[model samples]
Target: MLLRLLLLICAPLCEPTVVFLRASPSQPIEGNSMTLTCKIQHAPLKSDAQFCFFKDGQTLGQGWNSFPEFQIATMWKENSGSYWCGAKTASSKAIWSQSIQIDVQRVPVSNVSLEIQPPGGHVMEGEKLILVCLVAGGTGDITFFWYKGALGLNLETKTRRSLTAKFEIPTVTESDAEQYYCAADNGYGPSLSGLVRITVRIPVSRPVLTLRAPRAQAVVGDVVELHCEAQRGSPPILYKFYHEDVTLGSSSASSGGGVSFNLSLTAEHSGNYSCEANNGLGAQRSEVVPLNITVPTEDRKELLTSGVIEGLLGILCPTTIALLFCCWLKRKIGRRSARDPPRSAPSPVPQQPTYLNSPDPVQQQPIYQNVNVVSGDEVYSLVYQMQQELQSAVVEPPRTRNEDKDPSAIYSWLKKANDTDLDYEDAM
Candidate 1:
């Protein structure tokens, strides 16, 4: 105690006035608070004395302040460097302190996040897709992994010093749309991000239209259907049918496919037909299809006349054929009879005269001739087969010499005046 009191008087002359730089924590973790100080080694400085701090030959942003220390509220990896301090008085030359070194260790990664470019994860097909995995709080070299859904479905992995890693698809298709996430590790446990869903939109291609009818031809009153389809469009597609540029009808496919529109055909329905398909992006039209509708003719009067004419023809045709056949048969029989005489029956038989010829025209009675039908002939023949009828009630007189010699004398008066000769007909 007596030695310490004696040295106090000579302390100022013996020791030099120098400055020292010190740190609150020589090694600080990233994002932690830290502080640096400029200390005078010997006697106290004047009230007007100023101090400054530096890092690696560069000023630590505070220039000549009455305060002798610098404070770092948060430290980072980039803040690690050599540090020093300096001091000066209004009446004396400036002085500096020896440099000190501080290292701010990097914190382990946490809070991983997955994001998509053209945000919302809504992408069009055939376009590029970018997936970015971010580290909210991490330092040093970090390893990032992108997952579609679970860790088993790993999409990509990258190790670098960057805060974020990216996975890019040059051309995305429908199969690429799904849920995704990311995991980050910086010498620490892996941290997973929330799920991000991707939806792919496919633009409607050119549609195809088809017309189907119940019959071979599309006539009036026929029920036909128009089929419209877009081979590569997304869901809830709207289909519209047109005829000669006029809207006919519309239909939709909520689950994505083809649709049909039924049409009751009429005379006015005949025209060029087409169809269009849309899924909110844009509409596409199909090629024009020509349609023709035919209407039946109306002719009640002509139909009735034709029916009557057909009925008459149907009835008269057979009758005409029968008449012609009969006429031909008659001609054939007449020719046959003329060519060959009949063998079954005699030509004529002699008979007593039924009436005598009178000179007065009014007194003459009509003479009836008997007709016989020959089997092979067609014309009427005068046959005297009624000899028994003529002799039924007539009184008979004994034959005289002249009656015996000329039996045909009884028919003399019925003959013409030029016939003077008479001959007897032999009985067959």
Candidate 2:
């Protein structure tokens, strides 16, 4: 019929193209091995074309022979999908190509987890810190990396097979603490994840109470000590001590810096002395140190009551000034023996003259009338007699004067009255 109408007029003037080449490893991994050729552009190198292979629309292989490649050794997971290739020519009809989509990955029994959003991984340097990686039982396109201790951070890809994969750190320092994990690859090998340690909290700082006294004069049984510190805290701190507000001792530095507290001094431990450091992120204090307490002159009842009050004022002040000067010299010798006085007693020796004229008295006394007789001689005689008689006896002595005498007998009676008045005037 004119060679069948010249092969349908040369198949509408040579138009036959069924490409589908490229796929050596376009994306294949599950047990690996791939290849998919199938050309046939302008057909007719001897035509009679026969190459086949289609997928999404079924029909894997029905004809092949010249330049029709299509392998897939071992690759599974249903050998993925979307493939194309066709070219029939024994007289034309059927031509398809262009449709390659063979994915197949699946080497991922992964299971990489590492989530920490606001869950106690304790963040505070500046805040905000999330990790998350997940990706369990993966299969096709899946990347997700993110590490931290061994470095290597951020990397996510999950084309359409996701399960989770995040990574943020908007702040959070102190070298970001460290130790975190997550990984998952999908093209096989690489599934890490199981390490999570990140802590960065820091707060407690105002403490600094230092006393340490072995002797700067904190006496009364001394022992003192007390050091407490907190330069830049972040540990198990907790150091407390205070004194005018009571609560005296407590110490616990647990790996950080300072802590002491001994104290034994008494006298009420004087006064104001503070310190507190806590570490749960707050609680500071410290700054009020006074502490006085002193009373040691080698005390022993205060040195025996100051030596018995200075030995009773040094023995009653000189025995009360020598007993007031012996009572003022016994009242000045009894006021000088009552001012002066008394002596008296001594007299009598005039008898001789009396007798000289008395004897005549007796005889002449008889002449009474006017006897004018001239008797000069007789008168003399009579006078004598009368004098004698008159001179009579005189005797008066003993009127008490013997105060136990003997002051040389009153100077020997004034030397015997001046020798008897000069011998009684030479015996008259």
Candidate 3:
């Protein structure tokens, strides 16, 4: 009892200057070799001081040794424990080193898998997406990395001693569409997971249908084209053209934009035309476009014949009226000529006798006695014969000026003859 008390009291005075335990590798894989060292700072380098190793408060070996190191050739899971060392001298109390815990882990990770929170990997744009990375058949703390195609995404690393790790994407967009994968590393190496494909679907917008024809009016036997498109839609869109709600034709735009269809127009094709665009999301129809087909005027024989008849009548009616007018004018002229006889040259006026001796000398006029009077029937026959001569002269293109004399002269001569006849009757 007295010796124990003295040892305890002197233990502090002769304690080693510094003592600590260190392992070559703080973490070691299973089946690897490692060395644990116990160092004493105050002891001589070649001192023969005996050292003893302890594991979890138990002695590892039966006795002490001059060396201050412990080696493990083949580490195992069971070899993980807290270890320390103690130094003893013949005249000093024993000194203990600080404790250190060693951990033996399994081999590096060999497999990694990624799974989406919502199965099938189909997600809407602007929605959150969760990805979970799983490590298979590995031990130790692991680091997980997320990747999109060949590019690395900005995701927080997971450094946990667990079999599964999670990575979250706040929002997804059209630009995020690509193949994704993950990797698991445990200091030894990294293992990549299988690729997962993601798709982003877009809804179809209102479609617009436009009609193109060779002329302002669609006619029979003319070719017409219909184009359909959407302002926004996904690729591989199916377009269907409709005429009066009947499907005329269909087309597809593989790269997305627009599609067109052609038709040989007929009379039956005149109706309200529209189109529909679909891309698996939904179908959208465009506003109705009116198409009118006209028939050519030459196609109907009855109408053509009636038009011809009306056109001939329109020409011949005016021509017939003009012909009757010319004939009436010619007959009126012939009758007027027959009533009036042509006037003979005016007779010379009688000359007044000049008498130089008297201021007032009486002028003497010559007096005619027996003038042969023409009968009315003879006058009518002479006027008719003169009219026949005038008509014959008009038929000949070239005539003298005398033959073309004014008809007014003939009228005056007739009046004079009537007056003279009245005077002669009075005288008788």
Best by lDDT: 1
lDDT of 2 by residue, 59-177 (tens): 77555545577786767667888888876667767666788888776767466888888777878777888888887676655677777776655443343356676788888877887
* Model 1 alpha-carbon miss at residue 183, Å: 1.6
Give candidate 3 misplaced runs (Cα > 4 Å). Answer: 1-82, 85-103, 151-156, 299-428
In model 2, what is the error at residue 412, expressed in angstroms?
Answer: 53
Could you tell me how far off, in angstroms, the CA of residue 184 lies in candidate 1 after the best superposition? 1.5
Find the 10 residues in a row with the least total lDDT in model 1.
407-416
- Per-residue lDDT, model 2, residue 359, is 61
Worst 10 residues of 3 by lDDT: 379-388
Candidate 1, residue 123: lDDT:
95
Q: All models: lDDT?
A: 0.77, 0.66, 0.73
Which one wins on TM-score? 1
Across 5-121, the per-residue lDDT of candidate 3 in tens digits comes to: 999988876974677788888898776788878787855644767888888888876658888888888776678899888887777667889898988887788779999867798
Between candidates 2 and 3, which one is better according to lDDT?
3
Candidate 3: RMSD to truth: 18.4
